[model samples]
Target: MSGRIAHLADVRGGYALEADAVVVGSGAGGAMAAANLARAGMDVVVVEAGPQVRPDDMTRDGPAFLSKYYWEGGLRMLLGSGAYPTMSGRCLGGSTVVNSAIFFRLPDWVRQAWIDEAGLSGLAGPELDAAYDRIFTRLKVAPTPMHVMGRKNLVTRDVLDRVGVPNKPLPRAVDGCIGSGDCLTGCRQGAKQSVDRSVLPEAVDHGARVMTCSQVERILFEDGRAVGVEGDVVDLDGWQKVGRFSVRAPRVFLAAGALHTPVLMQRSGVRLGGRVGGTFAAHISGLALGILPDDVRPWEGATQGWGGFSPEVQGLKFEALWGPTALIAAEWGGLGRDLSQMLQDVRRAAMVVMVYRAKTKGSVRATRSGMPDARLWIPPEEIHVVARQVHKLTAAFLDMGAEYVFTGVKGLPDRIRTIDEASGLLSNRLRGRHMTMTANHVFCSCPMDARADHGVVDPEGRVHGVPGLWISDASVFPSPSAVNPQATVMALSDLISRRAADLSLLDA
Candidate 1:
């Protein structure tokens, strides 16, 4: 599977590449679309804002990976009642490269809601099922084996079973995982099936050209139609401008993730009214920490292996999460001597994260410099819901034989010794500023809807009032997907590519 890849940092002068189709990203959506389009005999070129970090170059150091691959050096902040840190990858494979390898089909209920509320048709039928099947087979999605499950995972499963809560092993997109417990830092063992290691290679095999360090700053329009894109090539080391480049094509697809896609559209002067970057949403999450009696070594096995939805709390999902020693220490919540003592028990620490389907809506506005400034507002009712879920999670940890639990709230007690103690502290209404909240799954900026007033794109992903322009990313979701969105993003992109192929645009 040999293909051509250009490292723009090595180029000295301005350049231009011509193609039948130009994709402005190389992540899950862009990679899948490029692969399918090239396989259909279209000359495709993928322009990526980040440098290419090959599997061999991947490392196990958490901070190092975040510094190299994360957007804004992993310092992206969501401004609102409280400042919340948001993370998104900025590499050849995009967020999929730095995410936990979790895979889930778009739930049937979510599909139906799109059809009913957003006027999206054909998505609740065979079309979506077929797309899921194709992606499942390609990524070798499977559940983590018991042998590979770490102590933290086993504890979570046991506690859920004892408490009469339904639980199961999480499905992951991997082939030969050795479980270094560093999926977020990038799979150093090359076992996790990220797009850079999977579909992107297939696209390249089909003759799609990939240009790393090439940021598409604007879309090239001619006579009210998108014809190509232009941007500057930056040095991979210092991120300084090295040269300028452009790609001319008959068609262009925006596959950048939710945060950047809308910004790109605004910078390109493609106005789909105010809906282009409105109605932003995410799965707001709460973090809980537990102290175990024995050494669990949370960082030794599958990073996130056991999780399930709580029947007691609708729209709340519980999952296990493990981080590096440094991260664990920071979240341990103590100063000086107390923190030093907690660090000694870091090896025995385990964490459970609760993700709630938030009802609050947000927005993303492009700054004058073309960077995204995201503002998220969580209502009072939603804050209470998250607080209640956090209390339940803390109790579950105690029931699992943990010594004490730490609720990740800013102005609360550092540790809880019993369920009664947790109940007392959580009785007070939690506000957005006091609760430590963050989101990994973001969606619904440039949504797909039948009505032009409701969204920016139609059901087929074609942008309204613009021909030869399409958006196939998380940004096209009409609302927040209650689960992880990587698989859904890939499936939707595949559907968009197939539709584009049927249009005969490439034959022009």
Candidate 2:
């Protein structure tokens, strides 16, 4: 039961297809859902808005990769008092294609909280653990090997060890990482087990069809039930709409991501009293760069190889980060001469980044042009907390013999050589406007809850008051996950899709 991948050229000038189920967006959630449904003997079609970028086509060119895979060329921002930049992949595999392959299971505390507070009993007990075991086995999730964790990551580990923090080599969804430091781009070595390389391939083997460059604009409804979907077939390079495509199916899974799922629901005229696009949230991140005594060759190691934790800050954690020179240099803001020096110094620099669960909730609304307009207002106190995380990371690096630390807070000096300087710069009143941060882990837009008034979807991910349409993405999270959400997304999708199949819900 082998299936094939259909590119834009394959469906030019109007195409029509039929499937037992259609899953929109072929990232972690969609891919996992498709695989589970297909394995259950349902004919699945996965429609993705982006191109099918192969591993052979991946390159080290940062800008080129960003333009090809990232939404809005990696410059989409959450609009508010302070514009917080965010990145999500727009390619066949979605964000997993462009993100570091770190994988984390749903933390017990987060899961228990969701069950107790949101009444998400479906996520309770051993079912999710079983799903996680399957996904980890399928993706070969394992601790990153020390050999590929070059000096950049090892140095961060050393600092954590000296500080007596809980640190370990990150468990990543990679088979054989060569330490190319190109995870933010794409894995040329084809080692990163992004759904495109793992779950989607299994889905295809189970006869699930994949269509790239097909943007689902609207959910086709019949008698208040999702009957199918239709949208434009976009050109891979220019992104121009060259044709139209439609998929008819009994069930539809909206896994178009947190940012786009709500917009798609609104565009389809699915009314839920503003629940579809409300209550958006994201993980807030801040990074500290340290210049070491010797050239670390930061770009030669695993992009994100290690993680550190401290008991003092419950939801705060640190990760070692490295990437392209130009992208990393963007942290140090300046013109001509200053920027050039930072670029040259990047060879000896590495980053320790902190990501924390945000207490602030935002909203996503669809613009008239059919784009997602997302806004998250971070309170001044949250910014100060993030700055404290940044200060802690900077102090740790400085203590570990870093020549100097780059605290990217706007009001702070570019280079801080002492813990006292870092502390003074990150005082209690630091505002959100002073920090340059980015969030890729965006979710909770279409949260799941037992009560209809609280969320757009039910605890099982079925859209409230919408028949035959379900959501299988991070958008269904009732709250922000304290850890990376890819594994959680995939695991939940697998659970939901399998349960739906087992219960014969597609025909209901």
On lDDT, the candidate that comes out on top is: 2
Model 2 residue 440 distance off true place after TM-score fit, in angstroms = 0.7
Model 2 accuracy (lDDT, Cα) = 0.85
| Residue 468 Cα positional deviation in candidate 2, in Å, after optimal superposition | 0.6
**Model 1 segments more than 4 A misplaced:** 9-12, 55-57, 503-508
Model 2, residue 236: C-alpha shift (Å): 3.2
Give the clashing pairs for model 1.
Answer: none
Over 4 Å off, model 2: 503-508
lDDT of 2 by residue, 1-508 (tens): 9988998778778689999999999999999899889989999999999998877768777788877778888889997747888899998899898889888987788898899888998677777888888888889999999999989998888766765678999999999899988898888889999889888988999999999988889999999999999999888567788898999999999999999999999999975998888789988888888888889988888999998766676666788988776676666745777777776677888888878886876999988878899988788777777787777678778877888898778767788888877775557767667777887789999999999888898877899888999999999998888888999999888878988788332221
TM-score of each: 0.95, 0.96
The Cα local distance difference test for each model comes to: 0.83, 0.85
- Best-fitting candidate, scored by TM-score: 2
Q: Going through the candidates in order, what is the number of backbone clashes in each?
A: 0, 0
